[model samples]
Target: TNLLGNAIKFTDRGSVRILLHLEHGGGAPLYRIDVIDSGIGIAADKLGSIFEAFVQADTSVTRRFGGTGLGLSISRRFARALGGDIVVSSVPGQGSTFAIGVACGPLDGVAMLNPGQVLEAETARLAATEQAHWQFPAGQRVLVVDDGPENRELIRLVLEECGVAVDQAENGKVGMDMALAGDHGIVLMDMQMPVMDGYMATRLLRSQGYARPILALTAHAMKGFEQQVAEAGCSGYLTKPVDIDRLLAAVADALGGRLASNADRAAATPQAAPVAAPTPIPTPALALAPAPALVPAPGPAPHAALPPLVSRLANRPRLHSSIRKFTSRLASQLDAMDTAWQAGDLAELAALAHWLKGAAGTVGYDAFTEPSAELEEHIAEADSAAITASLQALRGLQARIVEPESPADQLNDIKAST
Candidate 1:
């Protein structure tokens, strides 16, 4: 019931049914309780191990459906502790049934709600509360340093959407210089950039006695990067492509006086030298903007008066033109994502899709956000039926961004040009 209850929480349009079978013998009555669901079923090979301690069927499964793998393991343990064993039968596309057998006990007063009703209520309450809180601060300054145009733009879009003024640096050297010159409240520093990477930049900042919070942004490859990020002199670390809620929370934490700890630093270890540049993973059907590409062509410029919000976007001496340039670059990335989807290279399509979901919502592309989110969900599911449906919806969204209200027959004219 516990495991079934959680599955219902994550799954929509799934039926949860419990089957109870009783075997009466001369000695005692044995009871078998089975909980079945039409939701996403566990893979066959994984079904056996899911009940093992500390093991998850897949990491993304955990991310998409949040849980500690301990639930089933604990449930089995409790069942065994009470002189029964639990078993499972599942086929990935079909459904799953978890059967628990035990010695029958006395009748008791146990209350259960209609699963549909409870789940709906919980979902509604959570959605309502989420809509109401809306706690991000307005117009805070944020500096983003990343080598990839996609990454840079994604962060820029996110912060900008929350009404935070944003600035960008393509590499560590530039970001470091910007950090030294600007009066930013926070720095979102990416780990692997040309000229200077996040670690070197962080070390430099700390050496120069820079006290502002710097958050290292990297793909959390393993547990080690967490510690490496901290040791590199960052106050915190966020994994990419960043989750919007997590990113906002980290930003709020840094801004609201949450300080990094030595333990956090010790936990993030440096990644092993790479044999090859990690190929950009396709984001799951999310809308992605291109990474930020800053202008200036490595030349010196005279200082100009920046808006108060822009001034705080960096420690840089002047930021008047940079802010506008950065936002413009972000807009371009959104166009790029739209283009990728039309071309239909699944890899680029998925990457841009995932990026846009996070980027669009963060940057306040109000119309595109929810559809982008739905696109990501369908892409992650990746079933043939779901993907086809999602693809159509995505094309519709692309039309909205690039070609609203054009005649349906002429849609291809506005489709991405690969």
Candidate 2:
């Protein structure tokens, strides 16, 4: 269901066809279902591994598909639990075929259909229902593990506001301690952290049989992480700047309880909490994050050799605001274009290119978006350089935006260097 759903999502002009080949024998019929799509294809070596659960061919696919990777793994488990299995094959430039084989038999007779399992499945179903009167109960707890203060605070703010009580740990060690000590409904785990990252923490949790949901929260919302996260025993995955709606939906689905998606975990009206004085800083004409340590560029270049200069300047408040606005807007724009490219929407591709050109240039990314603008002007000409260069710039920008420190800290770095 998850793979098919994503196939439909990412395939616009192409056809998605499901072929069922059924055969009768061995006192039971064999039902073979093949979901074939001319969408983004998986690489040859990865074809064998994707069914291993949470495995995707590429990171770009995960951002486009927006899934936890549990869907296919769970689906496969369901198939196997019924004495059936799933097989898959694909060619990177071609397409993919997911073949699910099932034995025809009375489900009640299946040993996996016990009453407890039945009840748990039904609870999950009810929890997934979109009914308004169905309240899943408040004070339900979740353990959030992240090394970054901003990320933890953002998640804490979002979840606590939803009436779901929240607990937090900055590193894996603390997270494991709290997780093992308490009976929480779920764990929102960050994959990378200090002392003990989420991957190790989850491994430890699972080894101890902590059955509640454990979801991976990371900026690397790529395909492979899903399977990797699952190996760590996490139930699902959530990308950064966590989408409130998707997060709640996944949590509700995983925890067997319903929660309001509108309930922002981070929302809170300040009461007695003291407000700190705001510091002022200069906003370059274009605000950029400190570049990443390793960029996705095609070739090798000293990461620090990249240019670090101001495009324009703003007041202190504007500088802070501009940085946030700058980083977020570009990330969102690039992400959208990637989605559009996958869907093969030329119009959207053109529009995104145009928008990026305008926004990047406005914020001093002319060095980046300018090439893309020229490409947009002659998309029919197939300007690969423009496209490749633009992508490289975006990659470079991601590094800059997510420096070892905050944009605020980086600004100070710039001042000190100056």
TM-score for each candidate, following the candidate numbering: 0.43, 0.35
lDDT of 2 by residue, 1-418 (tens): 7657655544433456786544444445456677776655667777556666767667665443334355677888898887677776665544566777788653333332334665665665544442322244656887878765445554555556556677889889999999999978888888866688888999998898888888897655556878888788988787654554577777777556664432322132112322342222222211122221222345445455344534332222323343355556667778887787667676777766655544444333344443464446445555444455455545665665431245678799999999
What is the C-alpha local distance difference test score of each model? 0.59, 0.60
Query: Model 2 scores what on Cα lDDT?
Result: 0.60
Kindly list the per-residue Cα lDDT of model 1 for residues 1-418, writing each as its tens digit: 5666655533333366776555444434446677776556667678668888768887666544434467788898888887677777665644666777677553233222344656665665545444432244555688988776655665666566556778899989999999999978899997866688889999999999999999887643456787787787888887654565678778877666232234433333222332332222222111112222222234333112111112122332122233334345555565665566556555665655555554443333433444454455555555435445555544444443421222443466667443
Deviation of model 1 at 379, angstroms: 23
Which prediction has the highest lDDT against the true structure? 2
- What local lDDT does model 2 show for residue 248? 72
Q: Show model 1 residue runs off by greater than 4 Å.
A: 1-117, 133-139, 257-418
Root-mean-square deviation of every model: 19.9, 21.3
